[model samples]
Target chain A: MAVYTQVSAEALAGLLSGYDLGDALSFKGIAEGVQNSNYLLETSRGRFILTLYEHLVDHAALPWFLALTTHFADAGLPVPRPVRDRQGEALQTLLGRPAAIIEFVSGVSVSTPTPAQAQAAGAALGRLHGSAPGFGKARENDLGQPHWPAMAARCLEGAAAIDPQLPALIEAGLRATRDWPAGLPTTEVHTDLFPDNVLMLGDTVTGLIDFYFAATDLVAYDYAVTHAAWCFSADGRDHDPALASALAAGHAGTRGLSADEIAALPQLGVGAALRFTLTRTHDWLNTPADALVTRKDPMAFARRLAWYLKATPNMVLGR
Target chain B: MAVYTQVSAEALAGLLSGYDLGDALSFKGIAEGVQNSNYLLETSRGRFILTLYEHLVDHAALPWFLALTTHFADAGLPVPRPVRDRQGEALQTLLGRPAAIIEFVSGVSVSTPTPAQAQAAGAALGRLHGSAPGFGKARENDLGQPHWPAMAARCLEGAAAIDPQLPALIEAGLRATRDWPAGLPTTEVHTDLFPDNVLMLGDTVTGLIDFYFAATDLVAYDYAVTHAAWCFSADGRDHDPALASALAAGHAGTRGLSADEIAALPQLGVGAALRFTLTRTHDWLNTPADALVTRKDPMAFARRLAWYLKATPNMVLGR
Candidate 1:
C-alpha cells in the first residue's frame, strides 16, 4: 500500500456518507500496510478500521472479505464484523479509494509467541480452515500472481549481490515445483496468520489483524504459513519446535489435519516463506522512501528457508 | 514511488517552470519501477524520461547521478545528460513530485544475455566500480535500514510454504556470514543494477539507468549483483563459467578486475541473489495490487545459492 502520497480524511468521509456505519465521527489513515491504506475511525458508538482498497484487493470481491469475517463471527469465532452502510451495502467508495469499515481489536500482536501459543494459533488456523468452507467466498487463491516464477527470478537477480549461490537456489526451488498442488481443499484461509497478525492478551490469543492477504487457498498452505511464522526466530533462523501438538490439538478440537495435510506441511511452509520474501524483495527494489512505507529485507526470510527444512524433518519424525 | 491518489501535472509543471526540458509534449507513466514514477515523454528535442524522486532516494546525492552521467558522457561513455532548466537546475517540483529529465537510450533490455554479454556487463560494472571512487560526492549508502532483515524474515516465512528445506538453507547462509568478508574494497555501486536497468543494443551493452540505490557498498557485492543478474537462466539456475571473465574483459577493456574480485565473485554472487529474493519475498507478503507490481519467488534464487557454492569449487578450476 503506497502511502508516499497522502490521502485526505475529509474527502474520504464525504464519499462514505452512503454507508450504514452511521455518520463518520472522523477518519484518518493509520500507518501499517504497504498494500492498502488503513484508517482508524470513530462512529456513533464504536471505533473501527476503515480500509482503502489498494491493488491486491479486488473491490468487486469485497463482499467476500465482509462476508467471511461475518460468517466466522456468526460461527462463534472471534473475528471483526464489517459495518455496512444504511443502504445495506458493506462496500462503498471513499475518497475514491475502495472502502470498508470493520470493528477494531485492541491487543498486542504476539511477536514471540510461546509454543503453546503457536499450537493454539495452529488450532485456531485449523478452525479457520474448517469455517472457510462455510464462507460464501469460494474463489481459487492467486498463489503467485500475473507471473510468479518470473518475478522470483527477477528477485534472485537482486539478492545475488549478497550471496553468489542465491541464483541457483532460486532456480532449484522453481524447478522443485512448477505447478500448483494438484488437489486440495480450497477455503477462505487467513493466508498471513503470522504471530504479528494474531493479537494476544497475556497468554490467551485475542484476535487477528492484517487479513488483507486472506483468500481461498489450501488449508495446509495456511498451516504451512503459520508454521514458518510461529517457529522462526527474529533472525529468520530455526528455533525450538513450535507448539505443533497443541496447535494440532486445538485444531482437532475444531477440525482435523488429514494425512495428506501432514505430509504436505513442509512444502507448503516453504511456499509461504518464498512468497513473502519475493514480495518484499520487490518492495525493496522499487518503493520510494517518501512512500512512508518501510521496506522489509528479503534475506531475513531467505535465512528461514533453512528452518522450514528442519521443521520438515521434525514433522516427519513426529509422524 | 507512490503515485498519489490524485496526480496533478499542472502542479508539477509549475515547479519546473524555471527549468527547461522543452515543452512537455506528453507524459505517460511507465509503470515498471521500485522507486520512482517513470514516464516516457516526447519533447520537441527528442525522447526523454521523466522520473519523480522516490522512496529512499536521497535527493542530496543528486550530484552523484548527475555528475557521474555527465562525467561519463564527457569521457566518451554513451550516457544521458540530465536536462537542466534556465537556471541550471536539474531538479524541479511537479505536482508535489520532485522530478528530473534524462535523455532516453534507445534499446530494449535483453531477455537472454550470453556469457559474452555477461562479461561485457561485468567489465562495465568493474569500470563503474573504478568510477565510483572518483565521484566527488561525499555520501554513505544507507543499506543498513532496520526493516531490511524483518522483511527478509517475513519472506522466509512465506518461502516455507513452497519448500520447507528452503528456510534451513537460508538460515545456514545467514549464520555462516554474520560478519561479512573483511578487507574488501567498498565504494558507491549501482546497488539496483538489475537487468531491466541495463539497456543493450544487439550484443552490445548500451547504458545503465536508475541509480537511486547507488551508494557506497562492498565492491564485491556489486559484482555479485551483476553476476547474479547476468549469469542465470529463466529457471533461476545454471550460469556461464565464462560469464565472470566476460565482465572482467568489459571492465579490463579500460580498467581491470583484481584477483581478489575474481576470487570473491562466486561468494558475492550468492550474496546478491539472496538480497533480491528476500526483498522480493517481503514485497509479495505486502504488495497491493493497484500498483500492478508482482511478487517474486525466492525458491528460484534459493537454487542459485547451492549452485554458487558448487560453482565456487570450480570457479578457478579451469580458468
Candidate 2:
C-alpha cells in the first residue's frame, strides 16, 4: 500500500507515446499493491492503472502473471486486462522496470465480508479455476510446502518474542502436514485470496485481484485458503461456521469437490493457516520500522493455526 | 503523499448515503496531499477526491477553506468544488474526522514548469486573488512572518546534523527579513502555490489544488512564494530568471502590482524562502525514521534563500 518508485512526467509521457492511449491528463501514485508502484493514470483514452514491478517481485515471473490475467479477462472473468501498446506488447519496460498499463477494475474490497459475499467469492474462485485449464504456461507456487519449513524455522527463531507458545504450535502443524494428501486435483490456484484481494459490490463478488500469487496447486487447498481468509474474524480465534459452509456450498455448486478433496479439506486448512502465519510472522519481524506500509499482525494467523489444530473435516464442513 | 487514515467500505457507504453521488464504484487511497488522507473516489455520479482532515489541520478553519474554493469555482476558476450533501452541507464528518467530497479536477501537477506554464500558473494565482475581495471570511497565515523566528530557532537547534553551514545561513536569512516591508496590497493569498499544487494541461494551467494554506496576506507575497516555488531548479540553487519574469508579467496582466508591491518583491522573496526553509527544516528533522513519505530536503529552500539574498526587485521583474 505504498508507491516506492517515483515516475516522472517526461518518462511517463515518453512511455505512453508508444500506445494508442491519448495524451496523459492525470497520473497519481496510488496506495494499492504492496509489491509494486501503482499509478491511477487518466489519459484522453480512459482511466487505467500503470504498475511498475518492484524488486521484491520476480521479473521473470511477470509475463506469466500478465498472461494468466489476460486469459482470465478473455474468458469473461472480472479481472484487469493488460493493455497492449501499438507494437502489440502488453508487458514492456519503463524506468528500467517491467511495467504495464492495466484496465482499472471497479469495485471496493471488503475487509469484513458477509456470508453471502463469502459464498459469491467462493463461486468466483471456482469460475477462475474453471477458466485456467487452457493456460499452458505454468509457474510453481514459491511459497508452497517446499518453502514452508524454512519460513517456519525463520519464524521459530523469533517466536518467543511474539508468543512463547508459537513455536510449539508451528512444530505441531508441520508434523501434522508431513504426509498431507498428495496429488489431489492440481489446478491454477490463487494462493493469496485474502478479503482485501476480493472486490465486492453489495453481495456480489465483482472482482478478484492480486494474482501475483497464482500458481498450480491443489484445488481443495485453494478453497481452504479462502476459508481461512473469509470465515475467520480479525483476531482469527473465532470464525463464522455458516460462512465456511456457504463458501463450500458455493464452490461445490460450480466445481463439486471429490471425496478425496473433501476428506483433505481439514489438513489443507491447517496448512493454509500455517502458511499465512509464517509469512505474516516473517513480514512482521522484517518490515523496516519506518516503512509507510503497516505490517499485518501475525498473531491473527497464529490464533487461526490454534483453531485449526482442533478442527476436523466435519468441523470445516459444518456437519 | 500518504494516506494516514483508513476508511472502511461500510463507513464509506454510510457516508455516501447522505450524498446524491449514487454508489461508490471504486475508491483508492492516492498519494497526493501530505497533510491529509486523500482517496480517489469513483461513484455512480463521477470521479471525486475524498479527503479526511488530519490532526495537523484546524477543524474550525475548514468551512473557510471549503467556502474559498467554492467561491473560486463559482467564479469560473479551475478549482475543486466541495460537493454538498443532500442537506446542502459540504462540511461533514466521516470516520470521526472532518471530511469532504471534492470534485476531481483534471490535469497533472508538474514538478518542473516551463516558462509558459509558470506564466499561466501566475495568471491563475492573480485570478484567485481577484476573486477573493467578496469572500467575507478571513484566516490568518499560521506559518507567516510572526512564526518564522520560532521555526528558525527550532531548526537551528538541530541544523549542524544536516549541514554545519545551515544554521549561519538561516540566521542570516532571519536577520535580513527582520525589518521587512509590510502592508503592501493585502488580499487573500494562496500562501503555498508550489509547482506541485498547480495542475497543467500542456502549457495551460487547468487546476489549482491544496488550498489548505490559503489565507489573507500580501498579494505580492503570494507571487514571491510562487516565484521561489516555480523558478528554482531541482537543486534549488539555479533558477530561470525568464520564468520569474514571465510569472510577474502574467500576474501584472490580471491584477496589476502597485509600485510599493513591486519594490517589496525581493524582500518578500527572501521571506518566502525563509518561511519554507524553516518549516521544511523542522519537518526534515522530526519525521519518523521509518515513515513512508520522504522528507523534502530543506537545503533546496536554503539555497533559494541564498539566491534571494543577492536578488534585487529589478532582477525579479526582468527589467
Candidate 3:
C-alpha cells in the first residue's frame, strides 16, 4: 500500500453520483495503495469500492477493467463488475483522478492455504487463462521491470543497511542468477495471486482481487507466481513442497502442462518473487513515515530462489 | 566499508605504542563501504589498507585473517596476509576499536576474462578448500544472523517505504529458503568472493583477497561465487555455456571435481548471483549518503543471472 497525501469526503462524494443508489449515505477514504486511492462507498442501493487511479492502473485500461469484469461475470467466473455512471461512463473525474465503482468482493483472505487451495489457485489460473483470450484484446502485462537483478540489488542494499551476514547472501544471489539460458512462455497472467489476493470461503476460493497488474503473459509465469506465493510462508522461503504439489495439481486440472512448463516453474517462481521483492524492498527504504505503505526486504524473495533450484525434478524439466 | 566514525592518525598511533609508523606515515580517515571502516594507510612499509572491524567482520576472527592467508600462500595461492607487530598481534587496539593492517594488493579487476581464468578460480577455490582444514583451529564466519524470517520481515518493513511490490517477494524468500533440502557441502569457503575480491595480472590469476567471510561450506558455493563474477560482463542476461566449460576445465586442473559438482555448477552460479544481488540491492536503498562506504548495486550483477537462466541446460541442473 503506497498512500500519499489525503482524500476528502466531499471529493469522494462527488465521484459517487453515477452509481444506482437510493441515496448517498456516507463515504470514507479506505485505502491508499501504490497506484490508487480507494474509498468505501455506502448507499441505500449497496456498498461499493470507489477507486481513484494513483499508482500504475492506466485510465486507458479503465475500459478494460469494466469490460473484463462484465465478460468474466458473463462467463460465470464470479467477479465484481465495475459500474458506470448515468452517462454510461465507466470512468469519472474524482479529485483530479480517474475513478470507478466496483462491486465489493466478499470473503476472508486465506493466509495459509492447504494443498487443495494451491491446486484451486492453479486451476482458477488455468481457467482464467483459457477464458481470457475470449474476453479482451491481446495486451502485455508489462511487469514494469525485470524481476531478478533488480530484486537482488534491493536485497544487497538492505543487507548493507543493517545485516552484515546478509551481504554474502546477496553476493550469493548475484552469483547464482548470473547469465544462463532460460526461456519464457507468454499468456494472460495475474502476476500477483498470492494468498492475500485470493479470498476464501472456508477451504474453497470464493474471489480474487487486486487486478491492477493483470495482463497477457505466460500461463507458466502465473504458475511460477502462484507457486512462489502458495509454496512459501511469510518469508520468501519454504519448508514445505505441498503448496507446489497443490499448485501443480490445480494447473494440471486446467490443462496438462508440458515438461518445459514444469521445468520453467521454478525460474518463473523466482522471477515473480523477485519482482515483488525489489519493489517492496525499495518501498522499505524510501516510503515516507506518514505513508501507509510498508517496505519489504529484498533478501526475502532472494532466499527462496534456492528452492526453485531444487524443487522441479529433472524429468519434469524440459530437455 | 561501513565507517561509523573516522579514526585519525594520532588516534591510531596512540593505540600502537611500540611499532609506531609515526603521524606522517599512515593517514587514516573514514572510507566508503557497507562492510568495514577502511582507513587508507601508507608508510615506508608500503601502502596498506587499515580496516576497522565493522558489522560484518568480527574482532574474534582476527587470527583467521592471518592464518587463512598464510595457509593459502603456503598452498601456492597469493593471499593478503595481515602484518603483525612485535607484540605478535595482527590486530591492535586502535582508538577503542580493533584494527588490522594488510598489504594493499594492487591489480586491475577482471571484467571479462578468458575461459582459462574462470577455470583457474575454480581450481584455486578447490585448493583453498583443501588447504583450510590444516589451520590449527576452525572459525565460523559469524555473519551474526541467518534467520530467513527476520530477513524477510526487514524487507516487508522497507517494502511499503520503497516499493509496493515487495511483500510477496519478502514472503517468498522466507518460505523458500526456510527448509531448502540442498544442504551445503561444508568446507572452508570464501562466502564473499566477487570479481573485485579476486585480483588478476595479465590473464593469469595472482591472488584471492578478502577472507572476511570464509567458512566451512560447500566448495561448489565458492565456484558459484567466482563463476558469477568471471562468467559475465557488468550487465548481460545470457551466459555462454563456454564460460562454464572453461570454469570446469580450470577447476578440474586443481582438485578433482565430482560429476555432481559439474552438474550443479550452473544452479550454484545462479545461487551466488542472487545472494549478492539481494544484499547489495538492499544496501543501495538504505545506506546514508554521508557514509563513506559506497553501497553496491545488485543490478550490476543482473545480466549474468539472466544469462545463467538462458544458457543453463537441463542436464546440468540435475534433479
Candidate 4:
C-alpha cells in the first residue's frame, strides 16, 4: 500500500488528453494496492483509479490481466474494467510506466469481516469462476506447489532467524503439500481471493478487486485460498468456525463442489497456507526498510500452515 | 504520506452512525498529508476526507485548528470546514485517536506550478488574511524564530554529518533573522502555505488547505513563506523572477502590503527558509527508517536561505 511513482498534474493532463475523460479536477495517490502505485483520479467526466504499474509487475503479462478483468466485468461480475482511450487502448504509458484508468467500484473492504460478509465474498469468488469460461487466455500459476521448494530455499536462512522452529515448519509444509490430487475441476480462478480483495456494502458484495494474481487453476483451490484468508483471525492463531461454514456454504451454493473437491479441502488449505507463508517470508526478508510499504508478518501464515496440517477435511469444510 | 492508524470497517460504521453523512460507500487510505492519517471517505451523501491525528499532533491544539479552518471556510474562501457530528462536535475519537471528517475540496495540487498559479495561490493567502477579523482563538507560532536555536541544537550533529557546511549555514541563518521587524501588521496566517498546500484549477485557487501550522503572525512573514515555497525550484536553488513578481503582485493587489512589510520581505524570507530547513532537518534525522513517509531534503530550504541572505527587497518583490 504505497505510491512509488509520483505523477505530476501536467503529466496527468497530458495522459488524459488521449481520452475523453476531460480535464483533471482532483488527483490524490491512493494507499490501497500493494503491487502498483494507485491514484484516485477525478476529472470533469467521472472518478476513476489510475494505476501505474510498479517494477514488480510483469509488463508482458499486464494485457492478459486486463483482459481477464474485462471478461469478468463483461459477465456482470462486480469487477473493474480498464477504460479504453479514444484510440481504443486500455493500456497506455505515463511517466515512463505502464498505466491504465480503471472503473471506480465503490465499496468498503472490511478488515474484520462478519459471517454474512464472508459469505457474500465467497459467493463473489464463485461467480468469478463461473463467469470466465469463455476467456480464451491462460496464465500458468507460477506460484503453485512446484515452485515451493525454491521459495522455501530462498526463505530458509531468514526464516531460521525469525524463529528456529520456522525453518522446520516451512520444510514440513513443503513435504505436506507434495502429492497433487490429479483430475480436479479447473477454471479461471482468482488465485488470491482474500477477504481484503472483496469490497462489500452491508452483506452484499459490490466489488471483487485486485485480480492481478489471477490464473487458470483449480476452483477448489481458489475456494481454499478464500477460506484460509477469512476463516482465521489476523494473526492466524484463532479460527472462526461460523465464518468458515458460511464462506464454504456460500461458495457451494453458487457453484456445486464435487465430492473429491470437498474431501480435498484440508490438502488444498495446506497448499494455500504454505503459498502465503513463503511469499510473506520472501517479502519480509527482501523489502527495503525504507520503502513506503507494510511488510506482512511471515509468522501469521506460518501459524495458519500449522493449523491446516492438523485439520481434517470435515474440520476444514466446517461439517 | 502514510496511514498510521488502520480503522476497521465496523469502527468506521460506528463513527458514521453519529453523523448524517449516510453509509460509507467507499473508504481508502490516502497517501497524502504527512502529520496525520488521511482517508478518502465517500458516503451516500458526498465525499469527505477523514483525518486521524497522529502522535505528532498536539491533541489540545486540535480544537483551535478546527475552529480556525471553520472560520476560513465560513467566509467562503474555498477552505474545507470540519463536518461536525449530530452532537455538534467536530472533534471525535476513533481507534483511540482524535478524528474528524472534512469537506473534500476538488482540485489538483501542482508539482511544478506556473507563474499564474503562484499568483493565484498568493491571492488566496492574502484573501485568508483579509477574511479573518473576529477569530477570537489564537495559536502561538511555536515554530517561529524563537524555536530555531533548540531546533538547530537538536539537528547540529546530524546537520554536520549531512554536510560540514550545513551547521555553519544554519548558525548564520539564526543570526540573520535575529532582529525581528517591529510594528508590522499581524493576522491569522497560514504559516505553511507551500505549493502542495494550495490546490488549483487552471491557475485559479480552488482550495487553500493544510492549516495545521496556522497561527497569529506577521502577514508579511506568511507572504514570505508562500514566496519561498513557490517562486523557486523544488531544490530551492533556481529563483523564478517572473513567478516571484507575480506572487508579490497578487498578494499586493489583494491586501496592499505596507512599505515596512515590503522592506521586511527579505528578512522574513530568510526566517521562512530557516524555519522549514530546521523542521525538515529534524524530521530527516529523527524519522525512523521503516516509516511509511517521504522525508523531504533539508538542503532544499537551506539553499533558499542562502539565496535569501544575499537578496534585496527589489529582487524579492520583483522590482
Q: Tell me, by lDDT, which candidate is best.
A: 4
The candidate 4 chain A region of ten consecutive residues with least summed lDDT is A248-257
TM-score of chain A of each: 0.86, 0.96, 0.82, 0.98
Candidate 2 wrongly placed segments (more than 4 Å): none
lDDT score at residue B10, model 4, on the 0-100 scale: 85
**lDDT tens digits by residue: candidate 3, A1-319:** 3223234433444555455553445343432244676655556677677777864577777766667766666676646677767888777776677778877654445556777777787777777767677765655665523445665564556656744555564455445445422465565567788776775554566666677777776777676677667777667654456766667777678764677776566555545655665555566667666443445666567566555555554312222
Docking class of 4: medium
True contacts kept of 4: 0.89
Tell me the TM-score of candidate 2's A chain. Answer: 0.96
Cα RMSD of all models vs. native, in order, equals 23.8, 1.4, 29.5, 1.6
Shift of residue B121 alpha carbon in model 1, Å: 64
What's the true lDDT of residue A97 in model 3?
Answer: 71
Better of 2 and 4 by DockQ: 4
DockQ: which candidate is best? 4
lDDT of 2 by residue, B92-150 (tens): 89879999999998888887787888889889988988888878777898988777888
Flag regions of model 1 displaced more than 4 Å.
A1-9, A12-16, A20-28, A144-147, A179-181, A310-313, A316-319, B1-319
- Candidate 3 residue lDDT tens string, B2-34: 244456434555554555443324242322334
Q: Report the C-alpha lDDT of model 4 over A1-319, residue by residue, as the tens digit.
A: 8888988898999999999999999999988878899999999888899999988888888999999999999999999889999999899999899999998888888888888888888778778877877897888888887889998998898888877778988998889888977899887888887877888889999888888888878888888888899999999999789898888778877785789998888888889999999999899899898876778988888888999899987778766
lDDT of 1 by residue, B34-117 (tens): 566666554556667777776546777776777667666565555667887788877766656567888877544555666666
What's the ranking of the predictions by DockQ, best on top? 4, 2, 1, 3
TM-score of chain B of each: 0.84, 0.97, 0.77, 0.98
Distance (Å) between predicted and true CA of B98, model 1? Answer: 34
Off by over 4 Å in 4: none
